[model samples]
Target: MAAPKPGHRRVLAAPIGLALTVSLAFLPGTASAAPQNVALQTSDGPQLSYVVNTKADAATIERVKKAAATAGGTIVVAYEKIGVLVVHSANTNFPQQMRTIKGVQSAGATRTAPLQAAVTTEIGAPEYLAGSPAATATDVPGAEPLEADQWDLRAIGADRAAKINPGSSNVTVAVIDTGVDDTHPDLAPNFSKSQSANCVGGVADTSEGAWRPYDPASDYHGTHVAGSIAAARNGIGISGVAPGVKISAIKVSDPETSLFYPESVVCAFMFAADHGVEITNNSYYIDPWLYNCLDDPDQKAIVDAVNRASLYAQSKGTLHVASAGNANHNLAAASITDDTSPDDTAPVVRTINPRECWDIPAQLPGIVTVSATGVQNIKSYYSNYGRNVVDVAAPGGDKYQIPDTPSKNGRILSTMPNNGYAFLQGTSMAGPHAAGVAALLKSTHPAATPEMLQELLKEQADNPGCPTGLYDPDGNGVADSVCEGPKPVNGFYGFGIVNALDAVTAP
Candidate 1:
């Protein structure tokens, strides 16, 4: 998901920002340096985004609001329930100044980039082969034209699950990413427009089609993810994992940079929780830091705000399924080198302790963290994994582990904007497959809580156990990754690969 890998059509690299591995010793000032200097910019300086966390009480919130105003910050949206406020201020000192306030728990800027900068993200063009028809109605009875190309669906038994149950229309999975094109023929049937909204700048914009991608051509990430979760089984394009469940779009990615900042992501979680959304598929991480460290003030603040928001959503019965990131680092490792932080500005290479620095929403408690697998049901080469970190595994595709399908493309194929289709690979793609299965479980057990659904999902998965001998998929003599734990639950496959057939059929 970190910027599309070189061979893919496009990279929805929000959650997996630069998911490549690089080694560097711990930089001395990396954790100690302030995110930004207040002296560098005054009240008249460039506008910046900040998150202020406080006690979730009316009195405390009010006091913080006043303090924010006095610090030269304007309230973008106040999530009073979580006591998280998205603030905009030109005062570079606002974060430092707000920290001094009595009620403020944590305060920091969300990014290094200014508000007006037209951040450029290299979004690969949508891939389409002219005259290459996806499929015909006669190919697979009720299956879509591209159904044959979707090895991912069969790998997880989603193709068979459809016969038993397509999922409950009452259950909805919110794709909280770039945006979703509900207008796509494959997605329109099961799209929940009423529940969808654009939470771009910490505000919920419910305008008609407000959840549509800012630019369908390049902002196709969310739509692709949505298609994998709930694209209808109509004889049109590709079919999603849980083709009968409803899906809503909560656009949180910035239009220009395609970045999912903390404020927008927090707003999205709060929106989904309040809107009766049963599940959320978080394919993108709250950027610019790949790992939000507890030691860093700004990073810690991001961790706090996002944790609060996710907790609020969970309490409202919203089960969160997130990608474990594309970086192949062992999440449970003692130390990991991350060269990508503050991606909106210049990134600093630093060594981080995984225990303290986390890949939020995914590593956060209660989230069903997913790692990617390929056609062979082995861990994808680029998926991040840890024995206790990953909750489940799903088909996110592997170019090296080619499938025997017609397309023969080792990537997940799903609906794109403007009736298009493309192949993408990442834990971003894997999370949706698990999310779709969760939707099926929710559909079957209408009264199940988020905890219950998670348990059921894990119970129903097929544990392949750890791979025999060296776990090297690319066949390199050197091990690409080490598999830890017992077969039932390991770093590479978690509780093992998700089973869609079991999801809908289990008692």
Candidate 2:
């Protein structure tokens, strides 16, 4: 989610759920270095966002209001049901001060980022056709012009799944991402107008086109994700995995393309829960720290706030699906390196244990963590792998590793911003495939629970043993990363590639 600028201010690469990946450093005067009883950090200016957790009651809410006043912090949006409050503060020590208030369960600066984050991400240089036009042809009922190019559809057996069940129009899958281009021809047919809203500044805005993507650099991500899940089978462009479902654009990313923050993320899930959303596709991680350690009080509050929001959504029957991430490190490993912290500012390098520090929402409880695979049914070079963490695999594309074909560009293609289509690759791209399958399952069995869908996903996966030896697809004559686990289930493939066909046909 980090913006692509260098020097003075570092990158704000919030690639948790996008195809964009860039390394950056943390800056000063950010939330991660929350100071005590002070408004300004010696290094940076006054600008901060914090999340406060308290008991769910009126008395605690009053105290929370008073505490915010004393600390020069203002409430952005407070989730009374879950006891989570999004606050804007100039006081660097606001979090430290808030902890002293009675009835406060936890308090922490949500992100190590400033109020107005600046970030830019590249989706990839897609292979645009010679005469691709922004205006798509009239709709009919068959394969779209680009349907043959969608290898991801066949890879997950979505074609077979469609034969079993084309899904129901009643089911809506929310794209909790940068934003979705609801106006795209392929998406407009199945777009749920009432379910779309912008949670950009930590508050839900339901104005017309409020959830539409505007930033040219990163907005394409959410749109691409929506198409992958439910682009209509109108015989024009491409077909989504579950073309019979509807898509909701829940915008959470900011204007500068900064990463999704805890406040926005919380609001997104809550909104989905309240509006009857059946499933959510999360391709990005909450910004700033890629791994929030539980030991740190500030980081703990962030994790707690988000966990509460997601849990509440699940309680309301919404399935939260998250991407495993593009980093190639083994999450199942005992330890890992995270050099990017407070990425909104300047970052500091650090090493940590996975059990204590988590790549949130993905590693968070109840989330269905998805891994990425290329056209060849092998793990994508950049996808993170874990025996205990990853739940399933799907086609996210691999430019260098997979075999080439005009249609198989080794990248997933879907609706771009202007009613057009383009390619992108990442674990960010894989989660939606699973979400689409889950939507089909939900459509086929509306009475099913999240637990039921999760079990069905793993059960239907086509299990294959781990590739023997060093699995390096780049052919650099060196091992890229080693595969772990066994057949039927493994660290890289997680139960094996997702089988959408079995999901709808299962008895």
Candidate 3:
């Protein structure tokens, strides 16, 4: 496959296919409580995954589970704490029919792909890096061998922060993406095997080596993200933002498609919360729909279930940091066009109200939505922004924002699979930087709640305000994006660029 686009990272190309025709007439609060007999046999069509949501009560869950079985749905996993059940069923009308069951709050299919098998197609091998960049640094004494090329570290003051406090070993930030390569030298020192798990099918598989990438070459996204957050500060390779902290993997992306579905994401958050994880980095959005609308029952169910899981994690003291996408669209805008929805199958182009349609986990409340910045401290050309949507900014890299390093590459350099290092850019890269700083804060204040950690992140950030004049980084006459709000908090940079030094030293 070709290199991932600048804004979208690790997203596989959507093959053109037909969508399964399903009814959209299901409405919440309109279903009857009366019992009805529905046949319980799996259909001949491809098996699909669905999320049956109910009130967070044992009685309600039990009732739903019985109803689900009668509706031809086999329970994959049941999260009683959130009242969300992952179910596999071949019946095409499972979602529509489940919505009418008593005690069932909202239900819908999680992905456009069938549940029988994951979509795996190796179009081509990803371009891999075998060695460090051709850069020598004699000025920055005591720095790691490849740290000089990590302009992102210096940009966030993480280079200076590490001297004061390299975070704490007890603090763990979960990388909830594709699986990670824990054997890499740079990441092996700080890798926490006990906290890692494979959550590909909405279930936690903690077997030995289960958290590794399914394919080393194509499934290298999570390894890069882990290296950015907590790669050890050893002498051989690049140092992470919070080098002293431990990092774990929660593999959510599917094998070949690399798509993150709602069931997997919900499992990741729940697993992180139940486990001792203090923070989570979500760089990818939920698949199938780029923007889920609240008015639509199916989309609304996805939004509700994901938000419930995230809130549950936050309540349990886990801070969530997410990327603000790469579309470059203002999330605070009145309207926007989404042409890539139902991406696992065919898509329908349509205009949507931004207020009603949201990019899950990122646009969701309480998630620290981070925008991407370059070496110049300006918003990356492809970074999505909004007045209240973006909460902070970090180095996600810009091909146009040339760095002064020997390699002169504008992207971030981090660990890849098989003892390799590579340069890649996206808001996917930006979220981990913030997560690293949040981990540093967690190390400093071990007793702080998720709310406190989030406040500290914004309060300690260095506010650069918004850029003056039309925002155009390409030097072309055409304007790229518009900034909003005052200097301290704006659409582009949010509260400001995250300050790693402050994170380690803040009271």
Candidate 4:
């Protein structure tokens, strides 16, 4: 991700679709327990960041800013247009104190992590090391020599998709995750440096390479996802799903601390909307509160802040595409246990009413949600599914679940920092494919609104009927998960895996 010039990197350092009529969250795996490294999860004690929404009018905004100041918080950034103010406070009571202010519509700590938590590993990282090392250089006729190994691309027929339309540079898909390596040769050809910015600190920084991985060795998530969306049509590396579109990065997740808090996310959306981003691929979940409950004031405020930014982005013509998570649970269920909230702090397991609670941005309105499938076109073993949720599906690979050839590793391959490529599984990898397809659709139909795109996404999916009864892929005499809905649109493979070919050629 590109950071704003130094001045814009202000360190708050915090942190779809699927018009399936239902919703879900985006992320690779579940955080069922507290992190082992307490210090890295929390900063000095419990410094927290918050987004306070109020009336957009100057008087009300001033009142809100004034209230935050009085509440022992510093204004990191104040988005007057959305009437949202990002503030940081070490005071544990800052949220409650601000809520009592007259002009404040909602206020809450975005994360339980202490301010300035050190970034660490992303959600249960899977090893992508192949028999051979990824090379910095590449060959032509098909990008990288490993092109033959990218079964995920062929599985979804992206090569064929490109033949039909190849997409358009006018459309930009922002990878709002860790950070994208703009210099990666595979990505450079299509990277939109002007649109890339670092939003790691509750603000956008436009510095040179400001949006790059904090630690190239560890934070390759965004780059991988970005490559999947728009790597390049160049003869060097592998081509992306929509190699013609441009890519932008909004760095929100921190590699040192493995955190993606609220303030940073709110900022990312605003940046995407303010810029010319037409689509955004969100492959990570908003942490600190995995499932925010509307009844809980603190959680509600966090959700409200993000929803406001997302809605604003939508109004500006950005179609948000998110992963359906790798939790392997039924998102449409009435109740589920969330043992991880405030992931920065000790987590306590609590059951939640799915209908009453939500995984922000994913569950948020107007997003085009995407699920994952494997070689057999069956749901990825770990992907979350629900009849009311999951709008579409794409190739995300399944190492232990779905069997496949050419890529027996059973994971998706995309660009990595330092001009490399790696295999990665999980919905985290799945979302990019959907984002790429969305980009192609936007390019083909420039006049299509976010709503129109959402409809077309589902309309283009090649449906695969749900798995037999319990979906016991392991055959351990126990069911994996249940799929609810009928044909073309069901729980497992929502609308079926994404059809890039249809996306480009379909009328």
Candidate 3: what lDDT? Answer: 0.81
Clash number for every model?
5, 19, 0, 37
Q: Write the per-residue lDDT of candidate 3 for residues 1-507, one digit (tens) a residue.
A: 122211111111122001001111243333444465654444556788888888778988898898888878899999988788999998888887887777777788887778636211111233344555334444678798888789999998999999999999999999998889999998999998888999988999999888999998778888998999998878867889999999999998887677888988999999999998999998888877888876777787787778788878887889999888777888888788887777788979988877667787776667788889999899988888888768888888888899999778888888888888888888888999999999999999999998798889989887777887777889897899999989888888888899899998777
lDDT of 4 by residue, 1-507 (tens): 210000000011122233111111122211122222322111223666787767568997887686667667789999887778888887677766666565666777787666664221122454554444335344434445566666777887888788778899999999988898899888888989899898986889989988998887777888888988987776665789998899999898765575777788888999999998999988877776667776777777776778778878998999998887766767777677776665777989899876666776677777777777777778877787777678888887777654443456777777888777777777777788988988888988999999899888888888878876677766687878888778977878767788888888889
Specify the highest-lDDT model's number: 3
Let me know the TM-score candidate 1 reaches against the reference structure: 0.90
* Model 1 ranges with Cα > 4 A deviation: 1-44, 117-139
Q: What count of clashes does model 1 give?
A: 5
Rank by lDDT, descending? 3, 1, 2, 4
| Best first by TM-score, ranked | 3, 1, 2, 4
Looking at candidate 1, what is the lDDT of residue 399?
83
Candidate 4, residue 161: how far the Cα is off, in Å: 1.4
The 10-residue segment with the lowest total lDDT in model 2: 4-13
Cα TM-score of candidate 3: 0.91
lDDT: the better of candidates 3 and 4: 3
Question: Which should have the higher TM-score, number 1 or number 3?
Answer: 3
Among these predicted structures, which one has the highest TM-score? 3
